[model samples]
Target: MELLLKPIIEKPNETGSGHIKAAAPVRWALASLSLSMLMPSLSTSIANIALPTLAQAFGASFQQVQWIVLAYLLAITTLIVSVGKLGDIFGRRRLLLIGISLFTLASLFCGIAPTLSLLLAARGLQGLGAAMMMALTVAMVGGTVPKERTGSAMGLLGTMSAIGTTLGPSLGGILIAGFGWETIFLVNVPLGIANLLLAAHFLPADRPNAKTMQGRPDAIGTLLLALTLAAYALAMTMGRGSFGAVNIGLLLATAFGAALFLLAQAKVKSPLLRLSMFRDSTLTAGLAMSTLVSTVMMATLVVGPFYLSSALGFDAAEVGAIMSAGPLVAALMGVPAGRIVDRFGTHRMTITGLVGMIAGLFLLSAMQGRFGAAGYIGPIAIVTANYALFQAANNTMIMTDIQPEQRGVISGMLNLSRNLGLITGASVMGAVFTFASGVADITAAHAEAVAAGMQITFIIAALLIVATLGVALAGLAFARRASLLEEVS
Candidate 1:
């Protein structure tokens, strides 16, 4: 894989085009890429704040309303890896511009969507655009920045994403209350256009390697991955509502599709996933930790809103405000955590982060129903801070250890792991809510039951963090062993 893609890095040299000469252009490039990256996170949460309004507008159930959110996520999660590889093959700039254009169009459609089905379709389109932006952003940064500064660049980018996540719900709530639910989608229009313009002007072209660009995309691999991911997403989205014949079929198809995809990948000459990348212990450990982190994060996001609106009787605006706290802390702490990774190394920071995360989850788990807003605030803040640290540290560890040539693929894999974890987390938590509430209904009583389920889920999440801490410890021990072995040799 490295050999195949080596020409991409070498081509700029051959063309006498050194690293991007002007600082202004580089900064603009970074800003555009970062903004594009911010869209999906913002879109995801903005809609959360508008869910109740959307439910009313479309006369939809909670389960049906969730599709508005899940549609985009499912599309992006399924396509990110495939699109990232395509960017590596074709051109990152080209893909990015196309993505931004599609995103903008989708946003417009979303704003005007008159029916639930139409809105969901638009959201899925938006996810396709998001996938392109996400796949290219990190790869573009890797291509543009000096090797020494890449970590810092990545850190800043991560911080921006955290900020977007923080802002989305708050902004969404305000827009929904003042203008209506449609304004959330409308909000993306100006930002998307600006990003598109800036990217065209400032971003460098992806000079593809001859070997990699020679062949078309692996069709069989692509189909298998798509089928697998779609099946899994269906099983997740439909599992809670009506587990009838169709749902059962979807779940069974998901199992078969996943199996076939893995088998197909192994046989393909240039596999989409490049399963061998897991050979690196650092990558393996990081991926495992990442999966756990994402699962917890997703569950908390999905469950928190339910808890706030149903359990605590908070309005959409209040729920958005409360939910915003964690991302706010995460945004603040992301850069510092990256700096810590630069100084202290990933292992120590990861272990510390796990400890903090476990502590936070435990605090959340222990919250009593009688506790007021003040009681909830402190624990939620702790959880957010710890999560931010873990995210920054984990990203640094994963990217730093890999070969530069593999950055795009690794980025895709990392994202895939996180998204898959999120999907799984939502499913698991949804199941808990379903079982605990004893029906698909969302009522005050059901809300309390949901809270109980969340409490149990948080405990399980905390245990996962404990398990991750053990993995971190094991990694440290292995590092020591490698060091000793090198010295003796």
Candidate 2:
């Protein structure tokens, strides 16, 4: 390792404090990883905007059209961790290469599908491939970048994702207008092929490491984890439309599956997820806070369109345009915010972000009655910027200084928390809005009632954020005390 790094870096005597610049290869790896990450995220967002066009193309019903998106989401969310574990076992690079190949092939199938069913099947295949790529992209980025600059590297990756997600709707509209819905999926083909060639040429070979799992992957644990995620995600997705006994049963089954998964991991010789890793209090705290932040931020996204269109009487097109501002701001600020995290540390940036989110939520709540969606663009921008900084920093805070081998599972855990948070945030915020509006029929709700409900929803969101802030502060204190004790010892 030292030999590989030596040629690319200045000597410690020459550079001040043993600082090493990342090699050309490392920079290439980061760029490659970022582009790889961007495509999957962009694909999802683009697909969302193309759904109406697809429905018309296939003459599909609302439920069937919805499945086109849900199938991909479900497949990706459920399989992310499992594939991450596989990366640790076989090799991330190998898994990544395979994933890109599969994704490229799946996109081809999606583009030429003769029927809606085939398209949905192709989408699911595409999601499976995306899951593998997403699972390892961050880990690979961390592996190659200089340790001191991990936050900055991650920030760059986040920026790519932010841009991809935020750019999706407008890009999709343009493609669908000038070309067709098929163009969206087909657009990925060339990009995927180019990325594949880049990966094949640039990325270093993955070799056996001390950190790779030695024995067979945990079959029972894998099954249980899949079940738990599937049940939970499905329950959350289904709950929005129907909150009946089946949904309740699914929720119960999710809990049951989770318990079994925990038990299975404990007993397994080589567990898919290493439960022991949580022994690090920092990792636990970061994951918990990540879950909370994801819940609030994503839930805010869930409500934004409804608030804009239903309450503020903005057109759908206008709502989409305004909503893009937040993510665009996030994309713009991501690298700078990450540099700050590298300079100061995760705790300070996270606290700053938490405070910003609370302020943004309060501002949104206060201004909704007066300025409505017209006044929302700036506040949401602030909120997303806070999220960008917090995510870029806090994500690395737990795994940043850890052993390289542990990265696969840790990265997977991070992804899992974010996905789980999105589901939780959307569900909780939806329930709060429903209760506050006192309207069983969302489509029929009065504009005044929706406006009132949105305000209450923001207030509730702010309160939840406050609780997360408290826990994060406590965790920060704990880490400081531990550092002091280590110094004394």
| TM-score winner | 2
Would you list the C-alpha lDDT of every candidate in the order shown? Answer: 0.77, 0.82
- Give the residue spans of candidate 2 off by over 4 A: 1-23, 239-242, 372-374
lDDT of 2 by residue, 326-399 (tens): 88998887777777888888889889889998898888888885765557887788788888988888886866
lDDT of 2 at 419: 81
- TM-score for each prediction? 0.86, 0.94
**Candidate 1 residue lDDT tens string, 170-288:** 78877888998889999999999999899999898767656666556788888888778888777766756446787778889988888888898788777777778776778888888
lDDT, model 1, position 467: 88
Q: Estimate the Cα RMSD of every predicted model relative to the unseen true structure.
A: 6.3, 3.7
Give me candidate 1's TM-score against the actual structure: 0.86
